[model samples]
Target: MHDHRRLGRELGLFGTDPLIGAGLPYWLPEGAAVRHALEEYIRDTERRAGYRHVYSPVLGKRELYEISGHWAHYSEDMFPPMDVGGEQVVLRPSLCPHHAVIYRSRSHSYRELPLRMAELGGMYRAELSGVLGGLGRVRAIHLNDAHIFCTLEQAADEARAALDMIRGAYAALGIRPARLRLSLPGPGGKYVADAQKWRRSTALLREVLDNSGVPYEAVEGEAAFYGPKIDVQVADAAGRESTLSTVQIDFHQPERFDLHYIGADGAKHRPVMVHRSVIGSVERAVAHLIEVHGGAFPAWLSPTQLVVLPVSEAQLPDAEAFSRRCARAGLRAEVSGERSLGARVRAARLVPYQAVIGPKEAAAGRVALRLRDGRRLDALPADEVVARVEALVSARRAELWEAEGGES
Candidate 1:
């Protein structure tokens, strides 16, 4: 097992500075590139899935959470509210309340059967110092969050759509689904005291899961305070299961926030709210990827997908120029001309593809390609190299080198 903390340092992905406090990781340039790639991928995927992205504030008035019931039920996990000009405000613990406000800002209609609002929102939670670790457990979190406002009749269908999105994302990332947990409220005061609502929400989720033909285990008292949820648990390389994605059905929040849409009969009706996240938290997702792939990221997600190495100082210009061309063509490339050829090649191995610009290849208007897995391609034209790599990136292939003609 590759320790993510050590790999993170060696790869220059991220670091923790004591001055910045624990569980707050500052993304280095390399890590930021990975984060950016993941963010773009999720955004594009959600857009194609009919989700409208939005930006919400990181802090909200205390009264907002009060209305949403977080103040009473989840205050211990929240930071102490700041007294801002005689009003209590706290960093948002979740994006649900803010999104509820967004849906209420304007009148919606039945024509908009499913109003899907999404955001890569930041959130804060006051974790115990002893429990805080790397990106997996952090006080500052970048959540891949979204909320769906729909009619009661559309709730099950919307939940099914959310499940499809989760499955598609996991498949793309090469993650195998380990289990499905239908988390329900337990016999405790921690949950909203609405037995009727809980029964209805849990039944709906069970129906959705049953209709989808996916077996799941129902666990009591593990649900969000407002509702029941379906959690997609994936096993990491070490076979430890973690919940990476969730689709929750909330009936309490809509009633609390007075959220409504005009029905076809011309009367206002409460819209059922569905809370979901395809990749739960960006930081945690990257950390999971690091451990799952053992720091050898998929070609499309790697920070430095290609590194150009010059055999000698004489080939420096060609190396730099080729790297720039790759960058211009939307590939992450860099020139390694600082040390001996052998040393540079070793460093370049940290990346997926290494292109050697030597006198022989430069004269031929081509470069020698060496994959991370020790396969070599002799004197391929620069354009061909770029085209091959671009195809891999476009397809989001997991491996850079394939035994069968390097297609991946």
Candidate 2:
């Protein structure tokens, strides 16, 4: 049950400035590095999965949300619209409506049955000040979001594909989903009053989950106002569950926006929209990782992967040169000779590996490698050390010491 806020401070990841605002965190360099790594990984994964990445505006005209029904249904969660150049505009609270507009911007045939548009976009929400915590609950969020527009016949397959992607991402992060939830609309019209559409969308999601061989629970009144969804609940290191990923079937927005595609029958047809987030919020995901790993991130994800420690002033040049070698080998490395060797080693615990350049090892063109867990490999050639770390990073190994032959 490590507190992410404390861990963030200890690791120099992120912090909030009251003068700026609450629930808004400023990412330090270390934090930004981790986020960059995550963004690149997700982008690569989405590209390989046939998703087209795009950037959309963070603010939209009032009429845009009106057309998408967000003005009526989710206005309370949105920031007040600002009068900009005589037109009312507000920060976007979600990316799906903008994506719908993107789909409607062009005419598509059945050949483009599944149009997957992905973006690591930012959104703003009006959350209560009392509820704001670290990255878990923030006014600003960066979502690993995407939307899929497809025909009714292709809806289930697309939904299944989204689920598969979610599972693969979780597996890579060493996270286990506690349960899958089918969130359906409840009574009293908290949702849209389209019973027929709701029933169809809910059934389609259930069918996809059942056929995919994934166990799930059905919970009413939890669906988004637009439609039902498959919500993934993941337990943190403390065993507290949080919803991190989702596959939502949106039937309302496409119809509200009059989005359409030409069918095989040569007629206009409404394409079903599936909204998804593989890791939910990038900020929150990093916080989760910090807490789960106790601020010692995996080698591939660590901001500072390697640190070169010079045992004495005479060894400073060797330490600096070794760091350069590591940098040339595509690893994040730096030399630290300002502090005592013991103090430097203690600070290097935040990193995945520390290479000690002492007089004996520097003379032999070698270094002593120290693992975060206090394991040591003495007198390894500098190139060999870089090669070993390069392999771990290339494989995206979750733990440096757990890589095969990594233990000394």
Candidate 3:
């Protein structure tokens, strides 16, 4: 079994420090490149799916979570409040409350019922030391969280659409869903004491699950304090499953925040809050990606997409020029001229493409492109090579080289 922690260290992706505290792994240069790529891809995906992105503060007034029920029901797992300018403020444990305030910022007409807001925001959890390990469990979380505010009539369809988006994202990331879980509230927890609301919310999620045509387990006592959720679970190499994506129906937050919209009849009506995540957290998502690909990310997601190695010192100028050309085309390319050709090639094995500029090939303004997949195409124009790589990356294709007679 492949352990992400091992691969993460071996690949120089991420690491922790004693001074920085556990569970807060700092991304290395290579890791940051991969993360930036993931962030850009998801932001573009969400924008196309009609989500309006927003930025909210990581800390909120103590009363904010209190009003959202996180302070009352989830304080034990939250960081303690600290005084800021003589007023108590707390690091937010979740982004729902801030998004709630944004939704209530102004009056909205029923025609704009479903206002989809998204943010790749940060939150903190007061996790126990023993439970913290690598990126899977972290005190700080950067969530791909979004909230949809719509009328009751539109909530179900909005939820179904979120599920579809989550599934599509998983496919693009090469992640396989282990199963779907319908998490329900159980007895003696901090669940809000509203049986009727619980039933209504639970029923709505149940219907959404049934119509989704995906088999899911209805597991009790595993829900959020506010409502039921549909968790898309993925298993690691060791066969341990965790929630990576989710769609939830939250009636309590809207009611608590007193969010409303002007209906067609010109009367104010309550709006339902639907919370969803495409990828649960940046840390966990990176962990899973590390394990899934064993550090050999797809071309687009690879940290260093192309590494140019000159066959000898004589070809250094051509190698540098080729690297610059690749960079101009938006490919991440670096030229390695310090070592022998064989050493440079082996050092860049993890990169998606390796370009070799020999004396003959360099003189011809061409390169011998060697794919990480063990395929090599010789004497191709440097511009043609750059264009093909840029195209492959922009399209986010799984394959390194485009489909053709020689490259494939």
**Top of the candidates by lDDT:** 3
Q: Count the backbone clashes (under 3 Å) in each candidate.
A: 0, 0, 0
The regions of model 2 sitting more than 4 angstroms off are: 236-240, 401-408
Clashing pairs in 2: none
Across residues 1-408, which tens digit of lDDT does each residue of candidate 2 receive? 478888887788999998989999999999998898888888989999999999999999999999888888889999999999999999999998889988889899989979999999999999999978888789999999999999888889999999999988887776667899998877764567788998899999999999988789998888898889999987665677778899988888889999999988999999999888998899878878887778787888889999999889999999999999999988888988987888888877879899998889988999999998888876788998899889888778776754346553
TM-score of each model, in listed order: 0.95, 0.94, 0.97
Error of 2 at 164 (Å): 1.4
* Residue 100, model 3, lDDT: 96
Residue 394 of candidate 2: its Cα lDDT?
A: 72
Q: What TM-score, to 2 decimals, does candidate 3 have?
A: 0.97
lDDT of 3 by residue, 289-390 (tens): 998988888999999999998988899988998999988999889998987788888888889999998888988999999999888886798888898899
| Tens digit per residue, CA lDDT, model 1, 1-408 | 466777877888999999999889999999999999999999999999999999999999999999999999999999999999999999999999999999999989999969999999999999998977677789999999999999898999999999998888887776667899999878774889898998999989999999999999998888988888999887655566778899999999999999999998999999999899999899878888887777778888889999999889898899888998898889999988887888888877668899998899888879999988888887789988988888788778766754446544
lDDT of each: 0.88, 0.88, 0.91
Clashing pairs in 1: none
Candidate 1 stretches with Cα past 4 Å from truth are 235-240, 399-408
